[model samples]
Target: MVDGESEAADIVEHYELDYDESGRITRGYQQLELVRTREIVGRHLPPGPLQVLDVGGGTGAHARWLAEAGHQVLLVDLVPRHVQAARALAEEGLSVRAELGDARQLDIADESFDAVLLLGPLYHLTDRGDRVRALREAGRVAKPGCLVFAAAISRFASLFDGLARGFLFDPAFRSIVERDLAEGQHRNPDRHPGWFTTAYLHHPDELMSEAAEARLRTVEIVGVEGLCAWLPQLAEQWEDPERREVILESIRAVESEACLRALSPHLLLIARRPG
Candidate 1:
């Protein structure tokens, strides 16, 4: 295992006090992330029935949908519980395959998948070298010219989250936010599961740089939640269909705006391996 990997896993295991991987993206502002990510990734994906490798795909959230959409999906995750949950989905008849694996060192054959996803790996791979190694593995597994969708937490995410939910009132959270803004390293030493886990939030430029270093050509880096990430009434708004559409449209309008990308909680980097 790489440095910090065990700590990250321990933190995530602790985070189960708040919610598990299955229910995480199904509610609140996180729903926006799930919705927008599916929309954006679906938009870029080639015609279906393709082979997809979902690296660090916790509990097969994306893999379940991709499989239902007719693509063959193989999901790899470090957490055994998550892998078991994903396998449970397969037992229910979805065609997703789940296995325990590391992102920096995939056990699969090279150039085997039509598309690759590194949605959760980058968030936990706090080391720059490890993150780049994960990206390079994504490239190595993807067919030439195929798209790779990588997700990252924005550097400003903790600050915005703290402010939005009054987490900043606590000095501990304030210190965590400070470090996140100053160095992009987020460490939660407290026992509060809501404080999240060890993560390396990324500046937009840093994500682009890492992808470039991995020899992946940048197609675009778009904000997943955009300006709607921290809205106080976002949950209420999401319940109303029309309001949700307006919110999604508003986000899409500025999803790619460089100045506003950092305002988002999560960013998705769309890159392609050179043919």
Candidate 2:
């Protein structure tokens, strides 16, 4: 493994955050992210029973769904616990192969997968070069013309999150937010697990640039949660189906609006490897 990846793996192992990733997306704004991500990605997916690779697919949340949808999926994660949890899904009859691997250096063959999902690696790889390497690896493993869906935390995410949750009141969190805004570098040096770990948030244009650097054709970059990420009544609104549809519709309206992409907490970049 590369030094950057080894350090990232060490941080992940020390923090023990991957264990909760499975259930994390089922609540609050994360639930919205999950729903929108599935909807957006699902719309672009080709016919099923295709070979798929889920790089850094934590706990197999998406992998399990894809396997159930009739795709042959191999989920590779840096965290051992995540791999174990994903492997357990197969015991429940989901057709998934879970393995421990680094995103920068996948053990798979070239042009192997019909689809490549780098849902969690880019953010964790704080170095720009490391991030590009991971993206290039995805491109190398993806068949010509196959889609690669990469997710990134927005550069303004810490600021928005702080203002929304009133975390800005805390001096430490405010400092974190300031650094995130200035440099896109996030570091929870105090070991505050809720504050998140080391990461590099991305500007919308920067994400597209990285894809280009990896030789992938940019299709589109859209906001996952749009402007509803910090709604005061998100939990309550999500409980009502009608309210939920209204929220989803609003997001779809502006998801592709380049002017407002940075306002969203998470951004999904859809690109294709050059055929």
Off by over 4 Å in 2: 1-6, 14-19
**Model 1 score (lDDT):** 0.89
- lDDT of candidate 2 over 1-275, digit per residue (tens): 23674677655765365237778786665689889988988898998788999999988888877888899899999888788889998898888999989899999999999999999999998888889999999999999999999999999998888888888899999999898988899988886756787789999999999999999999999999987988888888988889999999999999999999889999999999999
Q: How does residue 111 of candidate 1 score in lDDT?
A: 91
Candidate 1 residue spans exceeding 4 A from truth:
1-5, 8-12, 15-19
Q: Show the colliding residue pairs in model 1.
A: none
Cα TM-score per model:
0.95, 0.95
